[model samples]
Target: MTTTPDPGAAGDDRRLHPWSWLFVLIGSVRQFLVPLLVLVIFGGRREDGVQLAVAGVAVAVLALLAVWRYFTYRYRIEGDSLFIRSGLLERSLRQVPFSRIHNVELRQTLLHRLFGVAEVTLESAGGSKPEAQMRVLRMGEALALERLIRHRGHAAGDATAQAPEEDAQTLLALPTAEIVRLGLVSNRGMIVVGAALALASQVMQDNLFRRAFDFVRGEASGYVASFDCGGPSLALAAIALVLLALALLRVFSVLLALVRYHGFRLQAHGRRLTVERGLLARVRSSVSRRRIQAWTLRESVLHRLFRRRSLAIDTAGAQLQGGEGGQSREPPELAPIATPAACDALLQDLLADAAWPPRDWQPLHPRAWLRLWLGDLVVAALLAAALCWHFGAWGLLGLLWLPWGGWLALRHARFAGWHVDARLVAVREGWWSRHWRFAEIDKLQALQLRQSPLDRRFGMASVWLDTAGAGAASPPLRVRHLPEAQARMLYVDLGREIARRRLRW
Candidate 1:
């Protein structure tokens, strides 16, 4: 008789599935609250109460459904594959082999934190979604499963049992002071300020900027009436109030940053990078070293003075866990705030063999500024004319902004350039804020070269770079107004390079 062990029984000894229903039900009820809130806001009391009763019954039904799903859902790891069975009515099944699993992600919500469990997803290299997910596993179980997958994925993705070695070294920690520094350095404060403004606007039923202007007008009127000040004094008082409002807004943003990035830490393992941070709630995420498709470095003029830069990474498989836009494809910040020297050290450690941001810059056409200057001047002139129409002779003062616009155009042109080598390509651009993007030539999916009628007159062509995991709506990088001949040569060279390299994905 042949003897074989059943892999489905592998985790039967210690696995727990009891809490999964609670977690799923909680998420469903949270979503259901929005409609109830709408009913409360707009419906009559009697109608609202009746609707609430109906909602309660509906939620009870959903709870029963969630219970059924929890009972049915089960997972087991055997040999080199994970088998998952879920869904209450349909009874879905997925068997993801270790070779197909690309990334293992662990996520926790507030309830998970309170209950000491987390959700785990096994992402395959297929596309944007995960191949299998196990919700509300005990912390220990989640971590154990993650480690198992990583250990297996490393060996399977490559030919042998070799995987990226894990150093398990802590790379960075944001102490109280550095956390404060991060708040000051990051633009995310804007998110907090934006949310505040949105909430306030909704409550007041008015735009925040308009509300501020009304407040300023009221204060200015009172000052003018009491002090007998002329128009200039009134203008100055109004400006003062506006400035005060702006200063307070800035402070609010910094505080928000402090709350969001508190207790942030970065750790590096052999081929994985992990980030942990949060205030009231905590977030922990991992990025595989091999999955990094590209990186972008960003710095503003203010960021330059502080010697600070932000780095973002693009990865394959699924979208990053958290970022500004909620679009999984957005390149989430890897090092949100850091010095140039620190970034260099971090990159060297993370991407040991990758030649990133090649320093040798090949300049764009000197006349690249021509289009920018003309474009900005046209905009400024249009604005000045509109001001004149509104304010009459005084509107001629608006023309003074022309020089400022001209300077911006000049600055943008000076920083626009690119560098290319056999393995890496670095693109630098921006007017007020500068950004440097680096990508592997082999990673590029496609390239496009085009010329507008104006560009044709100047014998210039624009080149757009396409890479995997970049969303369909926008190309990852663009170089505008390069000499047409050079652009063509670049196009051919890039295509050749893409064809030459072996694509691991």
Candidate 2:
């Protein structure tokens, strides 16, 4: 007789189902208040006695049903997959295979922690939401489940593991010193300034500032009224000092957050890359070699001052979580950050022995800068003219913004560049500093080759690559001023890859 053990049975032993009593108790507690409140209102001596009894019985039935519903829900593991069976009226089954799992996120809410339960979210490549969420599980089981699924998917789209070791490319981790530096470099002071401004605006009853704050918070409107300035200049001075203090606090906060995530590390462990960072809530993110759709290394003006660059990965999967937009394929999740020069060296080394090719090319045409300049100038002029026509001299104050717009436009144009190769297309752009980024043809999601009337007049067009994981972030790559033929070819290539993936789906 064959002696193979049942894989499903082994997995079931490690599987967990939440305490049914928890759900039932939650339902019971919530239900208790409503009926009790109604009884207090309606209960009386003679006429309402029967009605009260009926209401009490109805509430008891509902509570019992809720308890039964909770007990009926169950989940188990089937080898490298998760199986869920849940229903009170009609049965339903959800199966999530390990290969399709994108991320296994563990969340511990306050109640969950108090109850010793952890929520496990199994995100997938195709689903709009997590394919499976064990809403509640013992902490131990949740951790084990995360480990098993991550380990079992070694052959799937993971990158860190498959990075070529023989090539001797530098792998980076944020050191304590660097992390501290990053924290210092971060602009946390701005946050404190903003907060103080908001509080002061509230006290002063500045509707404009209050509205701006409310907009960011995604809330409904609040009462707006003017404040009485009863205090004198000394009071104003004290307020100013408080504002200054708040600004300092914000700076520290930014530094602390940066330091916490500083010295970020990325290590290749066969086929997946694992990233760990946190000041408070530790985060571990992983990406596979095959999922790398494109790469972007960006330098802001401040980063230039420090001779540093921030690197972000634009991959084939959805963006890293906490993304607020409707689900779609997103730009790459950040792998690790490094210096600009280090990025160039790292790219060269990593792609040196790869099956596909890397890129080398010229910056965008010089005329591109002129186009940027004119676009900004035209926009400013139109806006100024419109304001002058509408609001008169008060509107002309807006035109004071022209010089700043011009500087920003020129800065943007200065940094935009593009490179071409048989296997890859790289487009680089930024303001005051540059980012060199590329996407391989096979990994392209969708291509938009667009020409506005102005662009056509200038014999210019833009090419945008819509890869995976844009989430709520800005687009991953956009190359303006490419030749029409080149844009067409790119569009066709990208379309084919998108179609292939759709067919697979």
Q: Which candidate number has the best lDDT?
A: 1
lDDT of 1 by residue, 3-28 (tens): 12222345453334578888778767
Tens-digit lDDT track for model 2 on 363-480?
A: 5545666677776677777888899899987777767667787777677776666766545677777686566667666566667889988778777778787656445544457778
Worst 10 residues of 2 by lDDT: 219-228
- Report the number of clashing residue pairs per model: 2, 28
The list of candidate 1 runs beyond 4 A from truth reads: 1-17, 155-167, 196-237, 318-330, 396-398, 471-475
lDDT of 1: 0.69
lDDT (0 to 1) per candidate: 0.69, 0.59
Worst 10 residues of 1 by lDDT: 1-10
Q: List runs of model 2 lying over 4 Å from the truth.
A: 1-73, 87-90, 107-118, 136-139, 154-171, 183-246, 249-252, 255-264, 315-320, 323-337, 341-359, 382-404, 485-505
Residue clash pairs of candidate 1: 165-270, 166-270
RMSD of each: 5.3, 9.0
Angstrom error at residue 360, model 2: 3.1
